[model samples]
Target: MGLRKRAAATVVTLIAAFLLPLAAQAPAQAAATAWTPGISPLHDGEWVMRDIPGGDQADSWLKNCARASGIACVSVGQGDGKQSIFHLYKCGTRSLSNFIDALSVLNNQTGGAEVRFTGPNVGTYRAPANPNVIWKFPNAATYDFNTMSVC
Candidate 1:
C-alpha cells in the first residue's frame, strides 16, 4: 500500500482505539448519574425508604435487598441507638413490592418492630404486631420506612 494510505489507516486506528473505550464508558456514566439518590423525582419509579431500625436484622434486610437484581440503588444511614435510614432508588414495581413483603417477614421474625414508611403516592404504614399483616400502598412510587420504638 502507499505511505499516505498507511498513515491514514494508522490515524483512523488510533482514533478508534482512543474513542471506543470512552464510548463504551458513556452508558455506565449515565447509569451512575441515573442512580444518584434524591437528584431526580420519584415519578420515574424511583423509591426511598428511611428510618429502618438499625441492627443485625436491618443489616440483613439491607443486604438482601441490595443483592436483588431488580434493585437499582441502596443507601443506608446510621441513626441513634441502632436505628437506621434507608433509601432505595430506581426500583421496579414488582421489586419494591417484593421488598415490602420481605420486610414484613423480617418484621415478624424480629418480634414485631414498628416499621413506618413515608413517601410519594405512599401513605404512612405502621406495621402492627401481627406477622400476617402487611401494609398496602397501591399507588406508592417512593417511600421511606423506619422502625418506631413502641413504648
Candidate 2:
C-alpha cells in the first residue's frame, strides 16, 4: 500500500482498538449504575399499589401517602378499577422505619385488609396494629403492590 494509505489504515486500526473495548464495556457499566424506575436511591423502601379503583378508597390512600413526610407516591397509570396502578417509594433518610409506621397506621385505618406485594419477591401481608412489628424486606430489588379490597 502507499505510505499515506498505510498511515491512514494504521490510524483507523488504532482508533477501533481503543474504542471497541469501551463499547463492549458500556452495557456492563450502565447496568451497574442503572436506576430502577419508581425506586429511589436515596430512599430505602418502596411499595406499589395496583388495580385500585378511583373512589373514596383510592382518595384516602393518596391522602395518607401525601400526609407522610417522607413518602413519594406516583400514579403509574389510570384505568378501570382493575387496571389502575400506584407506585410509592421512600424518599426520607429514615424511610424504612417510617414506612413501617405508615403501614401500621394504614393497617389500623383500613381494618387489616389483605395487602399483596409482587415482584422479584411476592407475599401477602396484613398490617398489624403494633407499630413494633419487624417488617423487613431486604430484597428491595423490585416489587409491585396490589389490593383487591381496601387497605
For every model shown, what is its TM-score relative to the native structure?
A: 0.35, 0.30
Per-residue lDDT for 1-151 in model 2, tens only? 8999999999999999999999999888765642222222332344656555444565455555545433334332232232122333322222121121112122222233332233323444432322223222322311333321223
User: On residues 42-136, what C-alpha lDDT tens digit does candidate 1 reach at each position?
Assistant: 44543455545545655555555445333322333322222222333332222132122223222332333344444444545544433333333
Q: Candidate 2: TM-score?
A: 0.30
Worst window of 10 by summed lDDT in candidate 2: 95-104
Tell me, by TM-score, which candidate is best: 1
lDDT of each: 0.40, 0.37
Q: Model 1 — which ten-residue stretch has the worst lDDT?
A: 91-100
**Predicted candidate 1, C-alpha RMSD:** 12.7
Question: Candidate 2: where is the Cα deviation over 4 Å?
Answer: 35-151
